[model samples]
Target: MAIIKLSAIERRRLSAFITCLVVAILAWVFTALSNPYKFTVKQIISFKNAPQKRAFHPLQSDTVNTIVQGSGWQMLFSRMNDDKKVIEVDLHTLENRNYVVLSSQLKQINFKKQINNEIIAVNPDTLFFDFSSRRVKKVPVKLITLLKYQKQFAQSAPVSIKPAFVTISGPAEILSKIDSWETDSVVLNGLNESYNARVKLRPSTEGNLEVLPKSVMVNIPVDEFTEKTLEIPVKLINNHNYYDVKIFPQKVKVTFTTSLTKYPDTNEDVFEAVADLDKWKLGGYSVLPVKLTHIPSYSKIVKVEPRNIDFIVKK
Candidate 1:
């Protein structure tokens, strides 16, 4: 390789020429970007004011390419952005026809946009839909929850959902299979107190299905749970002959967990322990198993003492 050394004066002249060239390139780019240009971008299509007499299912994907006329800077920035752009299409015309001309609604869609770019056209120009018999039905809302409770805390009562039922309108064939709709999962962690809030329902997976009153109010009762034990008398059931039966243990200790608020009200009266005498006569079993026949549904049984009792029958 050969090296060519230049004088100080020559080096300065070369540097000045390179700086001028860079400046010229930047100026040209700025001028070009200021000019008007047209470009295409894909946006999601959402419908509003759907026809009440008929249901519609779109034949194409929800995405549509929009041809936009704007400045070169707008086109450059729009292409660089990754956010989902949604265009709302009015379906009022569907009451008379099965297709919608996108060009006719460009003014409305553009008015909702924040940018100054003009939507020139929508690819496919027209949106086609299949009509079906419209059906309206009321279905129960099932709450989906992902809950974590603090130590020694639990749900004290049933979860309450205001307006337990929601009105749904969609195609008859599709709505027939849907008996219930679920809300978006309500996630709460380390909860120690009662919770009340409004949650959004899960969006419809199908394009034609619609749910009214998109959200519902939810209430969850929370409390600290404590253990309680009671001695419950054991009663014999299926004593057809009214046999004189004496059990080794007359009573069994029932240990359960209940909310602190109901601790005082929970007692032996709320529980019933019974031994089936039919075990000896029908099953020929020597011992009878003690079973809690009646107990509060909310109570969680911990342990039952004397699970099996020895019995003597007087012939």
Candidate 2:
């Protein structure tokens, strides 16, 4: 490598040339920025104050093209700013007209006062909407949950929602079809104990439909269960007494699995075992199965031991 050194006078001249070039460019930009220019930008329109008991469908465009006229600096600053310019349009401030004319309704620009500019025009200048008259209706809230539990553990009681019902407001046609509101589906696995969670309700797909309070608390009662055994006496029914008959075993054992909370309350009074006397005859060498009667649907019956017993008859 070769080393080259510059004289002090030469270095000064080079520095001066570069400085002048920079200043000239700056002066040109200042003049250009001072001139008036026209530019287009997007303005957000937020709707407000809709009619009571009515819903407005979504608009095709969420924003409007606004043409602004101002100095280059002002227009450039306005476009460069990241803040969303909100143009609030009150729907209630309309006549019998079915459509909204933005240009006429929102003539003034609602931007920062620091930016001195004029909104020359708004593209499309008008917005068309379909309004539906809605009525309030109370509908039940249904819980949606897919749950799995550890072995020997299960849901002991019915799942409940905090708010039994919710208010839905929508078009009469849509509301008439809805009888209940359902929560979003939630899957939880390996749950060994009680489970509680707040789940969000599913949103309606209809653009004009609305649901209040969007979410509710779900209470799922769970408990551990144990096996229980009880003996139920067998009774003979529809007997004519013309022939004497006897069942070999007079009692039947009923086994079941139930939650611990209900285990102490379990009793044989709710179960019945019966064998019809009229269905048999003398010298009949056949077994009669005991029929279980009045069994509670909630308890899981494990087994009905000795379902049938040999019967002896004398004529």
lDDT of each: 0.92, 0.78
TM-score, per-candidate, Cα-based: 0.88, 0.59
TM-score, candidate 1, is: 0.88
Residue range 1-315, candidate 1, lDDT tens digits: 999899999999999999999999999999999999989999999889988788999988899999999988999999899999999999999999999999999898999875669898999889999999989999999999999999999999999998899999999888989989999999999999999999999999777888988999999999999999899999999999988889989999989999999998888988889899988899999999999989875779999998999999997
Q: Per-residue lDDT for 36-109 in model 2, tens only?
A: 99898787776666556556665567788888778999877886899997666666643355567766654434
Clashing residue pairs in candidate 1 (N, C-alpha, C atoms within 3 angstroms): none
User: For model 1, what is the error of residue 38's alpha carbon versus the real structure, in angstroms, after optimal superposition?
Assistant: 3.2
How accurate locally is residue 11 in candidate 2, as Cα lDDT from 0 to 100? 94
lDDT of 1: 0.92
Candidate 1 residues lying further than 4 Å off, grouped into runs, are: 1-18, 114-116, 205-208, 281-284
Kindly report which residue stretches of model 2 are placed more than 4 angstroms away from their true locations once superposed: 1-48, 55-97, 100-132, 235-248, 273-288, 291-293, 296-298, 309-315
| Range of the 10 consecutive residues with the lowest summed lDDT in candidate 2 | 106-115
